[model samples]
Target chain A: MIPNLTLAVVAGVLFATGVYLLLARSITRALLGIVLLSNGANVLLLVAAGPAGEAAFYGRTPESDMSDPLPQAMVLTAIVITLGMTAFILAMAHRSWQLSQTDIVADDVEDLRLVELAVRDVAPHDEERPDVDDDAAGDDRPPGPGTDAVVEP
Target chain B: MTGIDWDILVPLPVVLALAGAGVAVVVTGRIRLQRAVSVVTLSLVLVVALALLVGADREGPLSVTVGGWPARMGVVLIVDRLAALMLVVSATVTLGVLLYSIGQGAASTDEERADEQAPLPIFHPTMLVLSAGVSNTFITGDLFNLYVGFEILLASSFVLLTLGGSAPRIRAGISYVVVSLLASVILLSAIAMLYAATGTVNMAQMAERLDALPEGTRLVLQLMLLVAFAVKAAVFPMFGWLPDSYPTAPAPVTAVFAGLLTKVGVYSIMRTQTLLFPGDQLTELLMWAALATMLVGILGAVAQDDIKRMLSFTLVSHIGFMLFGVAVGTAAGISAAIFYVAHHITVQTTLFLVIGLIERYGGTTSLTRLGGLAKLAPVLAVLFFLPAMNLAGIPPFSGFLGKAGLLQAGAEQATWLAYLLIAGSVLTSLLTLYAIARVWSRAFWQPPIEPATEGLERVPRGMTLPAAALVAVGLAITVVAGPLFAVTDRAAADMLERAPYIDAVFPGGVP
Candidate 1:
């Protein structure tokens, strides 16, 4: 039989810890949390497959009594994918750190601010604006939306 | 799951071979050698892809298992008309981009000098890895394998998207990374839940089992999977990350991504919704999402001066057209969506490549910084006009044909959703026309200004030729619409009727 309350509690604790770290600002912590969460999910999947009384190593035959191996194989694949992604994320974090001198999102407000500036800079009306000649051609749609006005700051 | 034979899975090895070559090129690190290797590897993959397509076209659907394991036991790769067609399209676009990138040579950005020590020849390897991942995704028969394929592509794409290492690229790359990782997490969780519920990862088998599950549980699980794919496909609200981040990448990188990557997401959604859960309820949700995606994408497109950014938004918008077809839950609708996807893949890539050419020749991609390109480069003008107009769904073009097919299918569905699709499509087309017209008026038709001419430079033969070649292909598709439509129609038919696929995998029955 499965380890009942102990295994459930451990899986729950792992999931909670993972969720906490994943929400953190630090990329490294987030990566670590993904790993933990995946492991937790693996355990949960195993428990869902029914009782896990004994290790597969103890039982030579899977037909008689053994924890399912499919979930284990899936977990193995998940771990490999996680490792590859973690490496890529670390590289990205390093690059972000080098470029902006900070890995935190708040420090990279320049680009976000640029888009706002661009939106505001577009003049409300131009000769190309459809409303210039559409007084008699009153439309239900928003006025400027139809105009092929220039959109550069 | 029984009619499919177990012998048609040779494309996997071919895909891995190219991936291995890319790894070798990166490890070797000699720039000249890497370039040569990339060209050879890409061309080889293209040839193999073509062969696979032709072979499958003649012999029908095929499947092969890892080692000797059964479909439920080990990884399975299946090839049918749809998969073969996607492989060929992906390889062709990749081949073109590989040629263009190799000819363009080393990038000339200040960031390259600053970060020269970390990695060398970043683009070539990443592109190869991405190709392998795309190929794997298209061919794989299991859900978890598809997840792995997505991770492979996403991780490599993060590298390619930020290849230049500029401030904007890095910033955009960060958002792209976070959003993509979140999607992956959601997808993985869905896989976990599905596995827990069914104990199998094979898609065909799961399709059979999914019907037996309680409707509530299945609906929740399917919704999770749909949300994840939607994020990857950049549909409507999930699309915020696309236009900003896609425009930050180098042109060749962006072009290949536009051609293949998001379509893979669309492809997966199509597969799952059409084959596994053919219900009427999700179609309504998809219809609303399609309407929003079309309108929002075009609206964003209208508000952009940057050609790349505008095109990126339009990319988001056009996804709605495809989803509209798939959302109808009719044979006609799925067929049209398939046709639309194939057409959009080639047409969009050609447009992006042309835009890159425009940026190179005209000095900037922004309308404010560009003017009088037609006077200086008439050939480039023709190149840009064809795909741009086609993308806007002008008549006598493949884009128009595909859009008409989708519209026809939408009408045939004859529901409130159908009317919504029809209206949304017309609006999206008009906005698309306006966006392309804006680019044309500013970048091509307008008279030259003094400062702009001073910055204007001759387009390099390296860049111009690829753009020219792509324009030719785009035009050929338009001119030969009848034949192309037949191919797309057949591919669509094969996809909608999943028996060929299920049969190829099972060979007897799925029992």
Candidate 2:
């Protein structure tokens, strides 16, 4: 069976742009990337159905002339699954915005801490040293007498 | 063979869990009812899985075409020895984790509940759905069905991972979700290409047709499938999201994910490699990947101070051992890999659950802050100690047996790469021991930095019981190792021969 070059090219472009958007720091863009990527995959599935023919129906089309029904079934299943996931991710993005007022993905805190320790050239074993002047440690400390005294009580 | 109809049972595990999930959701906010539904559903699945295991071992592979469609035209669910064994082990662990989570929910104080989003009522349903997804992946005979199974599990896992919608979890969830989506897209595209080439999505049909394709096309398809599965399996370079995302979730959530999700990926890799692309075409590449996964994962584990992160790293490392067995591409190798998957699932989940207990008892997972835990909770110490040693490949344990099997398989292959992997496996084992030893010495042996905080409750029995049961189950695997090995050996032979699976799907031969 001959393949459809035009549809294949469209799928490739979709994948390329989807991956580019996926690399962004913003969660909303990442969600859009997933949408595009799944759409690209769906298009590829349609292309995999091969050259178009009459709609697959029991009595309407001869066996040899009917288009493949399997790929269309698979593409529909994929689309539904993607729709569900898109809704879930959208909910998560809203929740993230509510929590932090921004949906930009943040670096892992533990990973960042490890990076900071490496930058300071201090062994992880010595991380507990009181005199090390750790910024994270300072942040965890309760506010001093001059600031937030009423909030503490 | 027996009077019971085994073919009908192939889909029961998936069906039961999914139906139970629906019931669980309907009973939401009624915690006790929801819990009952989950427990009963999983327990039924376990029984069904056990029956399938026995029947498959005794009779042969059992399959049922969905909606009464012919094998070539419609979806099929088949349960051979490998799939049945996976179903049994997964059901067992899901039940164990479910009980532990229920215990944890009961024991948590109201203030603790308010702090972390109250262990949302949605947990039970999602967990059940995850189990269904895992079972579906194991039993599916259609490649596209396998993809659907993956999405089922992944969607549920996304919910489980970020149950509370807290800042840290959302942060972790975003990365986890996007990476998983990317993997899914890649897998879908690969399926499309395979369909375009082979004209069928049924795995048995594909297995037959793939051999007639051009060598380059076959190789490209194989590599694409491998890349997608490798990400899910957490092999070397693709594993960055795992250690970062897994530790932030609540304990039981992390435990189930650690136990089953990655193993699903490994299972798919084993299936596709042996069935559809049966040759030594990519064995060397797999060996190199296994070696890198082992060494890098263990080295990361050694550097971690948090027990959760350390165990997560170790989880990634042990996946290498399974991959090593797969790379060997011999009967002995695949058998050992299967055994290792079962052993690792139990030990890893037990370790995580015990760590949860530790966090509750000691008030922190940080080694620097935790001290004198042996004196405070000797039972918890024992629970933790046994699994840690097992994970580190202590003798007379299932872990040791599984590792020894892989080592022996590597020795039989005796390629230079196999030797390199054997050496890597031993070193990784030793480093694993060192990592566990460090945790023991620092957390239990050292004196308390300060007196235990007042009102710190004793580690609740409800939580401890399930963990101890899992530890016992791990030990039980060692007790039954001989028979288990025999079954896995037969399973491997069947997988490699390819006749049993293909003939089961198309008993009359391909049309």
Candidate 3:
């Protein structure tokens, strides 16, 4: 069986750790979690191709013992996809840091406003006068609590 | 067997799109050239897709095996009535959005074209790539290729979603990327399991093998695939990322995203259910999920202040209508769902494009800030009103007909869950009308409290004409509904009788 259990155990631990980090507030931690998850997924794919076989090539082995090359090819493509995804996330994280000096995804003000409206039971039709005054220029600030100021002072 | 009939059309759309992307890339800085290349490419795609649709309609299902690799091995491009109709709808919607973006001067203007990604502007190339990926997703017959098609579109979308790298867009992009990756991971895992158990990923082959698996194993694989597709479809519980993600995008990007992306997932669910797993084991579960998606999505819409967020929520909700039909597991129900999917794609994109114009004409989309648009821009009022009513399933419109079909089919089933969906569908339709009417009264009918600074933006013909054109597409669906419904009827018939599809793709048969 070529230690199928060992790879399965490793995948489980990776998923557990990955899920833990994915929930963290920090963007970098989330990025790390995505990486771990991708790796675990790749391993799981390999495991799915059967536990033992020789390399899949023309002269490597009999057809029965030949490792299925399709899973390996699929995993390679997946690795490439994860690489591209990682790059995009890194760019987003960099941009986040550039704008806000932090990599955490801050709460969206509009979502917060909607939530607050629900909490306060303010009808959307009657939300104009006082609501705008309170949030848009509450004591004359650039943004309300939920909104973040990009570009550090 | 069919004398090389559909094979030629099979690769042309994706090939043309990829080539267009290449040209757009080389001439990145020349906005004028980019516009010409983009429009010509998509228009060509639209024409070909329509021909394919008509040909498939006349000829029944059409399929071609790639690289001559034989059945169950080659990547097949199938043009069944279902896939062909979806192709035509997606092509029309994409072409409409492409023109809208160009006419909106979204890509042409130097100011808007400000590159945050690289030295050269990427919007044109990325959009071309995105359209190609969408076409590929619709055509691909095998399981793994479908995943590849999704990856192509998702990669393109990441660049599009965070176009400006502005704070809100980047934040939205993060969630979109994460949720999309999560879906991909789950789909990949399920595919691996499917391959392991059945030893094949060609869907027609799997159909033969799947029924033989132990019930537990079969259910697990089916749920894994459903969950993955549901996440893509933005079904209720998994739809958390949609509202947050879509609203922050630019007008045209958001329009295409809202219109096309979730529907692809819905189509996948329908295809898989009818083809591979032809039973009603999960019918109740899907019906309940469908009901929740409708009520919760519309409720979320009503609660929103902004037009885009509200539209996004409704997008999620109407997906429920499609699922309701599919879950009924009958020919009428399936046809109704197919018709609704086609109708929703056009109407949703048109509404989003109209909102873009509303934002242009009125200076803001927030109902609070916008008012008196009925007088200010009557054409804009007409543009918004028609689709809004159509989307609400008002009489004589395609949306109404589609919903009526679903309701009639649900009534025939006589299950309590079916009745629940019927009530939920009607209630949701009325609520959609209310939600949209609220937008109309607030944004167009009533006098503005401060009179939104409209004259500042100088609403151009470029943007308005495209919105008008898309509205016309929505209307065309109504006029052609008799024939269109017949087509979907045939598609439903084809799907339920899987022999033609499996035989067409696999020649002799899967066995």
Native A-B interface contacts kept, per candidate: 0.40, 0.80, 0.62
Give chain A TM for each model in order. 0.59, 0.76, 0.71
Report the lDDT tens digits of candidate 3 across residue range B1-511: 4636665787777889999999999987788998899999999999889888888887777787788887666778887889888888988888888888877765345665564344567888999999988888888888988998899999998898999888889888888898898898889888878888887888888888998999999999999999999999999899989998998888888999988899889999999999988889999999999999999999999988899999999999999999999999899999999999999999999999999988876667888888888887888899999999999999989999999999999999998889988999999999999999999999889987784353536568888888888889899999999999999999999899898888877776576
Cα miss at B108, model 1 (Å)? 6.2
Question: Weakest 10 consecutive residues, lDDT, candidate 3 chain A?
Answer: A144-153
TM-score of chain A of 2: 0.76
- Runs in model 1 with CA error above 4 Å? A1-41, A57-59, A106-153, B1-9, B13-29, B106-119, B450-452
Candidate 1 per-residue C-alpha lDDT over B254-369 given as tens digits, one digit per residue, 9 for 90 to 100? 89999888999999998888667767868889999999999989998898878998899999999999989888867677767877787788889988888878877776788887
Best by the lDDT measure: 2
Q: Residue B166 CA error for candidate 1 (Å)?
A: 2.4
- Measured with C-alpha atoms, the lDDT of residue B428 in candidate 1 is 93
lDDT of each: 0.77, 0.91, 0.86
**Model 2, B430-464: lDDT tens per residue?**
99999999999889888777785573568788899
DockQ, Cα level, model 2: 0.61
In TM-score terms, which candidate is top? 2
How close is chain B to the truth by TM-score, in each candidate? Answer: 0.94, 0.98, 0.97
Candidate 2: C-alpha RMSD to true structure equals 5.4
| Candidate with the larger DockQ of 2 and 3 | 2
